[model samples]
Target: MTVIIFTVSVLCLLPQEVLARWACVRACPPSCTCTQEKSCSVLCDRSGLAELPKEFPCEASAINLDKNRLKFLSERAFGTLPSLKSLSLDHNNISFITPGAFKGLSNLVELKMAHNEYISYLHTRTFTGVKKLVHLDLSDCNLFSIPDRIFIEQTALKELLCFQNNFRRIPGAIRGMENLTHIYLERNKIEAVAYNSLLGLGSLKYLNLQENRINVIHEQAFQDLTRLENLYLNDNLLSDLPKLAFKGLSRLKMLNLGGNQLTNLSKTWFSDQVELEVLYLDRNQLLYIEEGTFENLTSLITLHLNSNNLTTLPFPVFQPIYFLGRLYLFRNPWECDCSLEWLKEWMENYKLVRDIPCASPSSVAGLDLGEVVFAKVNGTCVDPADLNLTTASSEITSTTENRFKSLIFTLIHPEFGDQMGNGTESLRNGTLIESEDGQLSAGVTGQRAWPSESLFCFIVMWLSLGLIGQSDLFFSLYCT
Candidate 1:
């Protein structure tokens, strides 16, 4: 009788809203705790809750029922909480959420139902009244299949995290969600990305498909994602790439393609990715790269090609990347031979934070390639022009003076004059080969031909120096 009188006295002393909140707290189930601070909250986590807590606070704005034994959420689980904004039911034994379970939480903005391994299926109308949801995390749920049009009503949803599931393909559940900007589908059993798989998600900018079994991707898989910026495709079974694999990603900035079985990089692999700044191709079996492969990546800043099987790179491979700020070429079996002279020069000239280490050539096996002494690189690779000059010099040394005069005559005038005439025809005809003006004419224009005078002077100079046996002097004076 005294307790009833004290309760009546406290109720009379409280304001109307406080009295109403007190009544709601009193109605809460004995096992759950209800708090009324700035916004009412219900905490029922790991409290052996077999079902949804009964008669939770009416003004509750958040409910946390994580790590519980709850099996299902029936209709009107939290009745008529118009201001409720967030709900988390993670790590529960829930296998199903009945339709209209969230019937009246109209302002719900975030829902976390992750780690519910038994929840392999979701009723289409389970999120019936959560129209304003913006973020949903359902990762690690072991979901094998999902129904279509499951998130069609969440027009404002921006992020959907569904990694570490059993999805064999990108779930068609988000087909009509145009506002979603991020989706995580890593650590799944996704084998391939079919054509138009992600059709309606135009606003999506960040996509993570790493750590999957994806070995193939259709050319038109990501055609509708015009605004996508960051894409992660690392740790997959992609042994080869299609020509137009990245055709539609013009504004892409970062791409991760590490840990694959790719044996080579073709010239046409990356398509329409002009704005790309960071590229990762580490941990591949790349043994060759076609010339001019990276010619179109003018805006690229950072490039990673570490942990490959490359023995040598072409001379012009990095010609197009003038603005490159960082480059990685470590862990390759670089053959430090004559062909690697260009690499030595590039290492000395191009500034890099990491030194390129050589893995071959016993002398420089463990040393940085920049420190190697390329003694045979200077003009050792003979030029064709030099070879022709050497052949001509050898012929001049073996020939007699008579042949030397005849050869000099042929150089001064077209049509070798005569094997025996020497300059006799030129002197008699006065050919007027304007030697001073560097011109050659056949008949005399006004004065005697200078070809005869020049030829006579060359013969005198050769005879004075006895150049018939000295091919080096002759080549230096004439071939030069």
Candidate 2:
């Protein structure tokens, strides 16, 4: 009788270990994952499991159930985990979760229920008990709206990712979360941005609103986001930027505004973002560029201006960009004319940006406007009639050309002096060998039948006259 009683007690302990081993089996909860420690967790994605029996494995600390077909978390579904700390139910078919689903998990610190095919939504404070929660990723979960209480209760939360949702209007300001540092709300159907949307998120650092239908952004929408580092609003319809659009984003490091329909590049509109490091403005319909357009971006490293309709870049346009390292100008319609004269030296000396197509009339496309091509074609002079610059202006360019002619003519032959004296007084004084341009101009201008042809003739004439007179005198003395 004693041996039979001991065997019965030992048999009872076998079921407990078998149950723990069964947690990792394919029949686990839809939102639960079995960990390597032989513990069952609700954080695993078990969407196909329909019903969850009572008394699940209670040793779970982290549960992953992101992509499952669970509709709700009933009271008994989560009653087993007395020490659960992390629960991930994202990418599941959960449309509704009763408040009693979390009745026993007072120790839960992290909860994720995003990307589920949800018809309902998670309003504010839907996760009230999990106050110690630090990270919440609800991106692409079809969250239409959320109440203010969602962030107010989770004070210890540090990162909140709610991008690619179905939020329509300006929901609520993400205020009062003193520890929140990152927020992502990209690819949503947001139309307008109201003020104070981020009133008290002091520690918030990175904000992404990329690929959204955000038509308008209020001026002070980012009023107090001073700690913000990077902001992405590319592929949005940001028609015009008001002067105060970047009011309090002083610490912003990068801003991307590519793939838009921007016409004017107002320097004052983005003057306040002093600490910005990179700016991307590619693929826009930008036509005009005012002076000092990029004056305030002192720390900017790389600027991408590819694929725009910029026909011409005004003179002194790149004057303020002293520290600029690499500039991209590919896919722009560059009017390669006299205005590009200032860029010849830089192009020859270094790898300056010039990967653009010349605009209009199919006259000059794909032409690499370099020194040999433009100078030979005289690409600088827009019209021969505008050679109407001041006579003094003539003092500058022609001195070298004429001096070169004079020097080469002297080197080749003897008497052609009269034509050289016909130059203007100012030209004569400046074109002599004393001037800076005159010496270099001799080697540069090869066209004027050798420079100063008349000057060379005059020298030959005087020398011949002296020698002839001396020879006659010497002959007469020898005869005496």
Candidate 3:
């Protein structure tokens, strides 16, 4: 009795499984391949499908309709596919999508409609019911702007790709998506970054705005993106920036500002970026960089300042980045002088120093800065401190000579000679007197004045002999 019951159970379940498989194969659309390895999958890629086929297997969980000629997505196009979790409509001629086009795809998690160039506009209700969508690709679609509230139902979306489009600004439709983590909007026409443009997206991590026309960034434009880790603004037209333009992004790891028109940098620009690891300022028109510009980037590992108009950089500008591993400073007209002596010392502790050729000072021209510093360290390069002191001493000597010449002139002037009757008395009294010509006549005002004509003559003779002996020294110090 037990054997018969076991055999009967096997007989009952075996045909049902076979029938289900047969039904799935029978329900598949013509010219489409169907598979049931784990869940039903329909692949109609490159089949030249003009429209979505009506007969899809009931158990279909994924459908790929790529490389089709479908120009329109009508209402309820894929009707009541409750089990549909993935759909692809890429590389199609899809130009129009009616309201309620995706009404019944409640369980859909991924939808791809990329490479459809004719889809320049979308209705507000185009994505009505796919609330569980986590990824969507609408890139290269020539979309200028997305209708507001088009993504209102996509509360679970995490990644959005809308790159290579005609957007002049960041779309307002993705403002409040709290779950979105990645956004690719590179190669667009975005001109400026307004303050409220990315207001409510608190969870965004990776944002790509490269190859755009972004010239202006309003102060605190990225204030709401506290969790953003990577941001790409390379290949733009930015020449200047507000002081607080990059505020509130403390967790950013990578920032690309290469290929722009920036002429200088401010120290406060990266004040809040303590966690930044990589920075790209290459291929810009940068002429000056303020000290401590990268001071707050304590975690920075790589930096790019190559291909700019920089002549020299203060060594202190890079002293704060302790963990810097790679630095690109090539293609710049670097003026290697004694002022960059500290750079040679700093480069010794790091192993990845690129060649920095000198552009000025013919003695060091065409040589790497490190080699020049090595060759000139032994009394060849003048210490800047000593140079400053020598300059100060020369100024003092010049002033002293000018004052002595004025005193001699006062002694010989005819108008002063007429006043000489009391000049001797005035000199004895240490008082300064003015001549008829309003010239300051040296008198005894407790200040140094010629005590006697004989003393002045003796001093002049002594200076004449001393100058003759030191003529070579004077020429070497001043003429060169």
**Candidate 3, residues 1-480: lDDT per residue as tens digits?**
557445433433465456364545656788899988888899999998897786566567999999989999998787666778999999999999998998878899999999999999988988998899999999999799999799999999999999999999999999989999999999999999998899899999999999999999999999999999999999999999899988999999999999999999999899999999999999999999999898888899999999999988886887797458888888999887677777777677676776888887665678887776433335676643455566677765554454344445555663564455544421233234454667554554444333364245435533643353353243223212
Clashing pairs in 3: 430-444, 430-445, 431-444
Give all candidates' CA lDDT scores.
0.75, 0.63, 0.80
Model 1 lDDT vs. the true structure? 0.75
Q: Which stretches of candidate 1 lie over 4 Å from their true place?
A: 1-38, 345-355, 376-480
lDDT of 2 at 273: 71
- Using TM-score as the measure, name the better of candidate 2 and candidate 3: 3
Per residue, candidate 2 scores C-alpha lDDT tens digits across 1-480 of 556444433433466666455444344443444554644444444446554433334556776655556677765356545557887776667777665466556677777767775735664546656667787777777778887665665778887888888877645746767787888888888776667677777788887878877778887888878798888888888777776888878888888889877877886666777777888888888887777777777877778888888876665766667456667777877776656655545666666565655663244556655522333324444411233333335654454344344444644532433344443332333222223443322211222322454344334433433354443343223211
Give the count of colliding residue pairs in each prediction: 1, 30, 3
C-alpha RMSD by candidate, in order: 15.8, 14.2, 15.1
Query: To one decimal, what is the Cα RMSD in angstroms of model 1 from the true structure?
Result: 15.8
The C-alpha TM-scores of every prediction are 0.71, 0.68, 0.75
Task: Compute the lDDT for candidate 2.
Answer: 0.63
Which candidate's lDDT is highest? Answer: 3
